[model samples]
Target: MAFFTGKVALVTGGSSGIGRATAVAFARQGAKVVVASRRVAEGEETIGLVKAAGSEGFFIKTDVTNEADIKTMVEKTITAYDRLDYACNSAGMEQQPTPITEQTEETFDQIVNINFKGIWLSMKHQISQMLQNGGGAIVNISSAAAIRPIPGIHLYNASKEAVLGLTKSVALDYAKSGIRVNAICPGGVKTEMFERFTKDNPQAADAIIQMHPMGRVGESEEIADGVVWLCSDQASFVTGQILAIDGGFILQ
Candidate 1:
């Protein structure tokens, strides 16, 4: 039987990029998938990919910043699958580079609310369900910025670092209860966000590529593969850890 043959996974921000990739990966392993995102059309497209992988899939229009939407997202998942087996909190946002001196409170709130607060809220509901189900796994998509300082994006840096703190604490709290909570710190990835960030600076783009020891940007599927492994029984002993899949970005 497939490793995840009877499992169910919830992936927030599943409309595109890493979230979409992780949802598809779970489905490929025979798990029914719940894809939660604000973009209905793109989320439904992800479900199509999941169905193409031959596993059942559902979509929930969710805004993680809204507590009610998050609760509904979890409820709808259980309503469809009866249990929650795994979750990937991949909903995140990155603003254009701005100095801290010029940063606005509105921008700070936007970044923190979605990137940090969203994951916390997600875990609150996901853990409650996992406790009832006896056990499960969760992967939060943190960033390399959380590990090392990055200039021009102070808000994004702070928000991602905060996610790590919360991930470790929650993992420790629930480790004894059979829930594994972990975070993935990915380096520069070739996503729409990355593309948007580097569009105006060819030299900056080249600098990013060279920063990774791998000599290239990471792919969404690469991160998805790690997420799948972490959520699988193979990683049962792993919790309260931050896995850096950053291709040596922090090493340099």
Candidate 2:
């Protein structure tokens, strides 16, 4: 539990779901956490959970799609913690199943901006800070859809796949610099995103659950375990790798 006794962790989209769970997980291990999301109320709530877990943290109202906001997030994290040891870029969006013909440029822009461009800008500034600190670890939240497409959310799938490529490329760039970067492909974890998905396609709820050989969907905390592990010293040798916490969704 003291593995991160004096360390710091940053989690984007930390207002709820996987991001919220990850922040609390880091706190439980003794790391001070920085929770960032555009949602102020939920973000502050995450901070409360972090404090309850025996560590201190603050919430930052941030929109990852903006480069300025991304820069300020890291800056603010350092301002509070002095250095950043781990980071998880979990801020992303899900697009409801829509035919390509019906999808508009607006949808494409919003999805790509949040899922792809956001991570890019995030990593750009984050890596700069990590390099200055002499080393750090980063975990990006991709999706199993990157490997097994759901047939409708093509943009979401593509954005996640791009995360894989970017993860490897960044890992290589900072390989000798004491920094590591990796991606996690989660299946149908019980997150708000999943709820929204199932709510939109009522029939999809069951179909999605059965796709997992585990006979059920995963919890956001389960994925949080993977994120925290990737950022821990136990994974010191793991980098540029894709860790699947999907309950065998991609197996079929």
Candidate 3:
């Protein structure tokens, strides 16, 4: 049987990048998938990809930072699949890449609410459902910046650091309960967000690439593969850990 056969997974920010790839990966492994994001059109597209992967899929318009929206997203998932097996909390926004002094309270709050609080709220509901269903796995998408410095985007770094803390604490709290929580810290990945962030400065992009010892940026699918393994039985012994999927970027 397929590794994830008879399983159900929810991917937040499933509209694009790592989230989209993870949703497809789960579906390809025979898992029913629920794609959640604020972008309705993109979420629908991701569900199409999930269907093309030969598994059933559903999309819920979700704003991760909104408590009501998050609760509804989980409720709808239960209504459709009857149970939740795994989840990838990949919904987040990129930092504006400005110095700490230039950053305003507005930007700081935005970063915190989505990158940190969003995951907390997600875990709160997801864990509740998983407990009811027996147990499950959760993977939060953090960043390499959480471990190493990436200059400029201090707020982003702080937010992601909080993600790791939350992941570890929750994992420990539920270690005996069957719900496994972990975080993935990916290094410079080449995604639409990356392109947009660097479109105005080719030199900055080149510098970013050179920072990785692998001589290249990582891919969304590459990270997605790690997420799938972490959510699968193969990683049954793993939890409360931060898996850095960076291409040796932190070594430097």
Candidate 2 segments exceeding 4 Å error: none
RMSD of 3: 0.8
lDDT of 3: 0.93
Query: Quick one: how many clashes does candidate 3 have?
Result: 0
Residue-level lDDT of model 2, residues 131-157, one tens digit each, is 899999999999999989889888999
Give the per-residue lDDT digits (tens) of candidate 1, residues 1-252: 576998999999999999999999999999999999999999999999999999988999999999999999999999988999999999999877787789999998899999999999999999999999999999999999899867888899889999999999999899899999999999998887888888889998998899899899899999999999999888889998899989899998
User: Which TM-score value belongs to model 2?
Assistant: 0.98
* Model 1 misplaced regions, further than 4 Å: none
Candidate 1: what lDDT? Answer: 0.93
Clashing pairs in 3: none
lDDT per prediction?
0.93, 0.94, 0.93
Tens-digit lDDT track for model 3 on 1-252? 677999999999999999999999999999999999999999999999999999998999998999999999999999988999999999988876897778898998898999999999999999999999999999999999899967898888899999999999999999999999999999999888788878889998999899999999999999999999999889999999999999998889
Of candidate 2, the 10-residue stretch with the lowest lDDT total is: 194-203
List TM-scores for all candidates, in order.
0.98, 0.98, 0.98
At residue 149, candidate 1 shows an lDDT of 63
